[model samples]
Target: MSQRERGTRRVVRSVAAATATLAAAGGTLLACAFAAPGAGDGRPVAGPGPCVPGRCPAAYPDPHGGAVVGRDNGVNVFVGGDFAVRGAAAGAEGRVVVEGEFDLAKGSGSPPAYHVGAVGVGSRVPPDNGSPFLRVGGDLKLAAGQRLLAEDGPVNGTVAFAGRQTGTGTVSPKAVRDTGALAAFDGLREELTAASTCYAYDKGVPRKPTGTAVNQGKVTVFTGDGTSAFQVFNAPFDLVAPDGSAQSLSFRKIPANATVLVNVTDENGEARTINTSAVALAGVRRERLLWNIPDAKVVRIAGGGQLQGSVLVGRRSSTTRLSVAAVNGRVFTAGSLAHESGTGGAGGQTIHAYPFVGVLPECGTGPTPDGGHTDTGEPVPFPTGVLPPGFPGLEGLEGLEGLMGRPGAAGPDDAAPAEGRELPREGPPMRASMAVGATLMAVGAALALAVLFRTRSGPGSGPGRRT
Candidate 1:
């Protein structure tokens, strides 16, 4: 071949080599970019207060991350706060959404935590086959055995974390940064607290007789008037017996399908601790009963009992030593939460997801020192007249976290339990190791350039050949 033709061939080779090198680098960066982060779940964005046909909308509209995240298809736990897992694998009976940090285990070498499921838990009928069961709005700290379980076996594709993920914990379908499922539960927090206060409000319906709460040691008997819509009862003391065992609650003549609200408060209306056992209900059902802890800041459930009603915490709440104590209804805390899970006994207790279907009456805000009215603010309705800003409305709320001052918000750092070490933004040293691929690409490009240089301008008929 002529020298000129050889030079043209050399130029073509060099151009190809350079293009290949750049493509390799670009590919590496593309892979990292895709792996970086986005809203995890591929679900469509949703507006607030979306309704399903047969189910009644919960009085407490659980939050979605700027959109309708999940239906009220029995979301067992909505932590407008955060929690951590330890010991044996802790699981939720229904969908669980945490608007804060969720750690698989406490920390490195602490205790291994695993999640095994694809569908939502704790429902009577079959769960919707595709929605994620567990969603974390903040960072996700993965452990060794975080299996996304299915009916056939352990599978993947249902868990989504919005923030950083750490450790080499085995998460099927490979864990990502976010699922776009977030919440702003602040307004919902205020609404729930206000609703609790309304239920306990002293200036009840006109001429309606007050239900009597007679404490009889281990069991408290609440005798109601014949009214069936809203049965208001006042417990001058805590729900537990002095000894704390077999502390049961019994209702009399509450009329069938009556929405029952039992306000167990401190005599002086001060901050205190109320330990409620897994209560037994005689006349009322779990979905219709509400135990409004309007004053207590800390709530502890008995070790082996299940409390059979929704707990409307009017104060900032936390489930202290929450092992084996199952709540049969929704847990709408007024503030942040520090949860304890994975330690339930053989029977295994968890927050059972039963929506509150109660119709409550409005009173004059609260009870004054003399049984009159303390005009705090407007009366928050039970089946609220107008939905509050965050209480499941049409407005599109952004983000997954319902930060400080919301019902269960302790703080941002309260993502994991206090004991564990905080994982970094990017997990394990594997990311740093990705640079090795770039290095290899650079070397290949250099070799290609050398061959092109030699062929085009060295010992060939090219005029640009250098000595």
Candidate 2:
């Protein structure tokens, strides 16, 4: 062929090859734009099963964290360890057993009248001073020490001392019985522990609330009367009071029937601290509110506050301590009970009799209301602009589309592709597109360079002057 024709053909072939490469790249990009999946339809995805408002099971089998005290006939204060009523006029409607020494002395009498109903001293019981009067309805058992002074002080009941005693303290009829009156507390604590574990596990982990979150950790605070039947799952943080007072957490106007359960998991046990002193239940019964702090070492209730709920602490461990100004509900602790006297007197804290009923009605029976279920394993809906798996290659396409608006080649028909067909709703991935584009461009450039080199190196094409 003529050299001119040959050169023209070479140019045409180069143009054709470049055009084909461009076409291929365009097709690949078009496939990505029209074939990628679109963003979720913004509808709530079905999770597990139908979630009727009140269809789920209660978070706890026994609400009130397992009934520690009965409604009518129950003790005012039941200590697992040693008991002391110093300068505090405290009485138990039921029997009071002091695992260690029982000191019925007047410490700082704010009420000025130090008295007890039924006192069972496990260890030495010293002679009662003539000032503060100590009363006992049932028989008092003393391991050692002088007989109780019932002479001047009215002893409605008898006094049984294990050893000899001599003092002004009233000594009632001596009777020797079993020293294992407090043994039942062991089984009660165990039941509480098991119930707490089940509650925590069922609730799962706590997620940040969509509303305002305070402090650095994950916490959900409800102001005024909380929404009906609220449940906190796997909540491992501090629940401060609404007023933001000295760690005084308050729940005001909680509905009479509403129940609130805070299940703190073992993983976040160290951060569990609840102060319900300023809480106003608005006539809500104490049994309605429950706090499952299985691993908590200390639970403090500030002064001048009344908490309406049941507190379940460690069962076997002796590190649990419950410090409260005054409690209207039941407190089951495996360790010690410290009462911060607002009255400034010792042993003057009055523990009113309120038995725990059962789990709150709102906890539901199936799973937590946070869209998590123990029965069917299904997660909550995904957030907007994010895509789940099952779509091939379009991985990270959503981000790319967000970064670089929409693809220029996308048409009206490409808005929603055929159902069941995967499409890149967003643009092609930036990195992948750049890499592929660059590779194709480079190949096209190399092909044009080869054509130029071949034409120049051919006969009579190079540096002119052939003889």
Candidate 3:
């Protein structure tokens, strides 16, 4: 064909190839997050293991509608005065319901076992096609054919708790922990280590926790009384800060509203004083959050079906689980990686959803109007603040500075990195490849244009022609 046509073909081919390569790369990355094994299954195990009832010490006060359950390890579960086990009774085929200020204390008792805040009458089924039986609440009914999550070998069986459930205050397998109490204890230990280290260093002392003065251990709790009470005990060991400074921790009565600020030197400090909520939340090991679960009561109305509820996946909220305390805020179910979770807390309302957690979906009514008054330094209508219809209002002023542009101007060169800006140490090969690709594309374009000009000149081309 003509030279002009040949150059055009070459340019088209290169562009097509590049487009295809980019598409393939994007597809692979997307699959990794969405299609990976156990990624889309979105299932959870069963409730926690049986709690070993602990004997209250002489220092323990009389039970005023409260109970204290301790673990062999440094863990304790305190059932508050207001805390009540709803739904089922012991040795019955029903769901065990927990609500209202259940305290999970770690490293308070002996033997160092993790304490379960609240446990129902149930155990995880082994890999045998045995009787599909589980202990739960009195109100639970499994329709014609329903089953709990159980192990049937390597793969999961029909009782997969990963999907949805049915019933009033229905407890699905999604909220269950597969590994049982042993796994819970391991998780508790890991949590203490991670939380303690984060708290110690964040307080700005040295870096790590000093094992001598303060062993960064925690308590596993089973039951708790919401009332303010104290327990006295001598640590077989001493507690130390990061700087190797020795200090003894007082096993005093923890206040109802006042949370334990582990790293703070000032006892008078409030929650606002701490920059990271992670630090503030650390004090209350057994705390509840509010999550406005929509269509949750519908599950009960339909005798337990796969009802839709919004989940919030944030830093602090996502890590927590729904407990008795959270029931006051809203009907809480087991949360997944895709949604938020929380437990019951103080001022527990049976209708309100308490203790928000994770990344929650927006579903609010009414369109937030953008009144175009932004010129007067008025707040711009943030798209994030507007929730979807039927969603609870989760709008709070966050990331406003970044959105305002005072911190980062629109210009590329003007926008400097906040702190560390690491550049590639060596990039000869990458630079060369990019340079070659750019040069080739530019040259191809120029040649194509030249060919077009020459062809248009019609056999008598004089200028804009290459020999």
10 residues in a row with least lDDT, candidate 2:
43-52
- Candidate 1 weakest lDDT stretch, 10 residues: 41-50
Please give the lDDT score at residue 143 for candidate 2: 28
Instruction: List the candidate numbers ranked by TM-score, top first.
Output: 1, 2, 3
Task: Estimate, for each residue in 1-467, the C-alpha lDDT of model 3 and write its tens digit.
Answer: 84444443443443344324323333222222222222221111111111111221222121122322221111111110112222211111111122112111111121211112122211111111221112121112222222223222231211212112343232222333222212111111111212222222222222232211224433111122233232111122212333433222222233443322222221111111101111122232222211111111111111111111112111111112222111211121221111111122222111111111111111211111111012121222222222234443323311111111111011111112235633233365345334433443443344334434434443221111113
Q: What would the per-residue lDDT of candidate 1 be over residues 1-467, giving only the tens digit for each residue?
A: 75433443443443344335434444332322333111121111111111121232334332111322233433445554565564442344445566677666533433343433322334322123444556678876656654433221332336667887776565554455555656422233334444455455432321233588887887778888877577877775766677754466678878888878777664333343344444657668677787676545455544456677766655434333344455666565544444444333433344644555565553312111111111222111121112223333212211111111122212211122235533234433335323433443443344344434444443421111212
- Candidate structures ordered by lDDT, highest first: 1, 2, 3
Off by over 4 Å in 1: 1-74, 86-89, 106-122, 125-127, 143-157, 167-176, 183-186, 202-209, 267-278, 317-321, 338-347, 362-467
Number of colliding residue pairs in each model: 24, 34, 95
Top lDDT prediction, candidate number = 1
Model 3, residue 225: displacement in angstroms? 24
Root-mean-square deviation per candidate: 25.4, 28.9, 26.1
Answer with 2 or 3, whichever has the higher lDDT: 2
